[model samples]
Target: MMEVIPKQFWEGVEQFNSGQFYACHDTLEALWMEASEPDKTFYQGVLQIAVGLYHFGNQNWRGAAILLGEGNNRLRRYPEVYSGIDVDELLDKSLTVLKTIQMAKPEELALLKLGEDENLPLPKIVRSA
Candidate 1:
């Protein structure tokens, strides 16, 4: 386990919360590259979800669903709170977003707005208090 969460992780979270999914992926990728085992998978999960959101914003429903499902599954092995993150909450929220994307028709996907849609608020990474 990592003794300390790198500054980059929080930076990535900030970017993610701000709807800067592409930047979040870049920020977390650096940390993910150096992580091992649990941490490696953890960071990858977060990164994947960020990219998934980016795909959703771009109206790539398939990419959004795949990454969101994969990412949520990856994080499922971890505790509700791991590395100071609320993994359970993240999973729940992302799953809702994923389902919305999965259920949308190809033509309807273009009309869906992430965070702006009443049903599809963008998932945010909540830090454990």
Candidate 2:
């Protein structure tokens, strides 16, 4: 069962889903700062994902690749559907983006489909009461 979602976390989710990666980073980072133990890892993972997207937005392929890889690794530790998030789907998307970058040569990175302006499909939060 899903627990009550915190206001800040919900806000972060909204920002993240709306492609406001920087805002998501800011919002989730605040939540992560006050979180503990397992939740801390969860929040950190989300925050890292946000920052990784932000880096992708800024055309920082290397930064995006590193952070996205690390973030997904942390998130994989959680249940497949923890806190209303479909971890499996999210992981798949992250992996797609990572592979796209990893497969490209530095100069050819611009030809990748996972660019900053790309309208990539993102995972949504399955909100629970």
Candidate 3:
């Protein structure tokens, strides 16, 4: 049986894709709040990733690193693909971005500009086939 993806999920994806990270978090949280255990954790992971990008874009490296690390940990237990998302790819990109931030000095990180010189690590919403 085919299940329909929630409108909230798609709206969250659109917000994330459009770089409205904070809005994306709010949209997804609306869905995640009512979810059960593992699925709730998964949605939280996605929300964390979005907020990580939001922080990164705004030059908040410490916050971004923390959220990305937390998000990655929550997401790690899931399969390569889950709940319509390409989990593996998302994890890879998140890790890549995290590593970049983790390696930079806090002062250097603050100096880093997003969408001006170096681009922020944004995830692609590749729905699983």
Candidate 4:
């Protein structure tokens, strides 16, 4: 049987992909609130992903790394939900991206100007549907 992805889950993903991290966090957190006890861990992991994205957008690399790492940790305990999505791969991608950003020299970081733009960079998810 196929596991149905909830509308709330897709909404949260869209918000995250759209660079509305805070909104993503709020949306997913609500879903987390209503999740059954056995499912709450997965929702909490999603909530952390939102927080990670929010921090990443804000140029808080360390914060993003920490939150993302924690989220991945939570995800490890429940790999069933991620069968088609490959959560481990996603976590690896995120960690690699953050590490690359963090390894840049201070001058490079200054030049990158992490938070100069008022607009958030929407991810590819926005264009899919």
Candidate 5:
């Protein structure tokens, strides 16, 4: 059977994809708090990415650029968490989106799609809810 991703992660991604940047930040931050050392590093990158996405959703190009840039740098330190989860590739696309937005170029933001499906990582609550 396919494993179910953590509810918090899915909730964060959903909030992010749905243009709820603050909610994404809040949800992902919860997950980030409970993560262990190595995993915490991973979640830190993810949180920054979420923050970037939040800024992007809010149309804050400068904020998005800065946070996404940080996220992109953090992404270089990690491998894909699993199949279909290429953190590096996603960061690259996000950076491109941020740069295009920063440059005020007419870019296709729709091309920078993150999955909407609910089937992803394990669904355990890392810390107390």
Candidate 6:
């Protein structure tokens, strides 16, 4: 049986994909607050990743690392493709971004540019076909 995805979820995904991290957080959080079990966790993971990117954009290395790590850990609990999303891709890309952030020295953190980095482009949410 196919699970019905909410319109707001897609809205959140659009926000995330467009680099509107804060808006993505706001959109998904409403769903997360009322969701149950796996979905609750799933929404949280995506939301955290959005906020992590938000932190990264603001040059808050510590916040970016913490939330990205936490979000990746939560998302790992599900299958590679959960809720019609390409979870495997998301996990891989986000982990790459997280690792890149983690590997940066404090002095060099501010110089790092996301999406512009050839090896560490901003992660996007890809819906499974």
Q: Pick the candidate with the highest TM-score.
A: 6
The best-first sequence of candidates by TM-score reads: 6, 1, 3, 2, 4, 5
Off by over 4 Å in 4: 1-4, 80-84, 101-107, 110-129
The count of residue-pair clashes in candidate 2 stands at 0
lDDT of 6 by residue, 27-117 (tens): 9999999998889999999999999999999988889999999999999998878899999899999999899888988888888888898
Q: Each model's RMSD to truth, in Å?
A: 1.1, 2.9, 2.4, 5.1, 8.3, 1.2
Q: lDDT tens digits, residues 1-129, model 4?
A: 126757877787777766687888888788788877546777787678668767766777778768877876776775533524555555555555455555777566434433343332222222111
Which model, 1 or 2, shows the larger lDDT?
A: 1
- Where model 1 places Cα greater than 4 Å from the true spot, the runs are none
TM-score of each: 0.95, 0.85, 0.87, 0.68, 0.64, 0.96
Q: Who wins the lDDT comparison?
A: 6
Candidates sorted by lDDT, descending order? 6, 1, 3, 2, 4, 5
lDDT of 2 at 76: 86
Q: Name the regions of candidate 6 deviating beyond 4 angstroms.
A: none
Compared with the true structure, model 1 gives a TM-score of 0.95
Error of 5 at 120 (Å): 24
| Clash number for candidate 5 | 4
Q: What is the lDDT of residue 17 in candidate 1?
A: 96
- Model 6 RMSD in angstroms: 1.2
Question: Model-by-model lDDT, in order?
Answer: 0.91, 0.77, 0.83, 0.62, 0.59, 0.93
lDDT by residue (4-74, candidate 1, tens digit) is 88999999999999999999999999999988888999999999999999998887788999999999999
Candidate 3 error regions (>4 Å): 1-3, 111-121
Residue 30 lDDT (model 5): 85
Residue lDDT tens for model 5, 1-129: 115446777677666556676777788788779866555565666678677766665566677778877867876676654312556456655665556656655464433333332321111212111
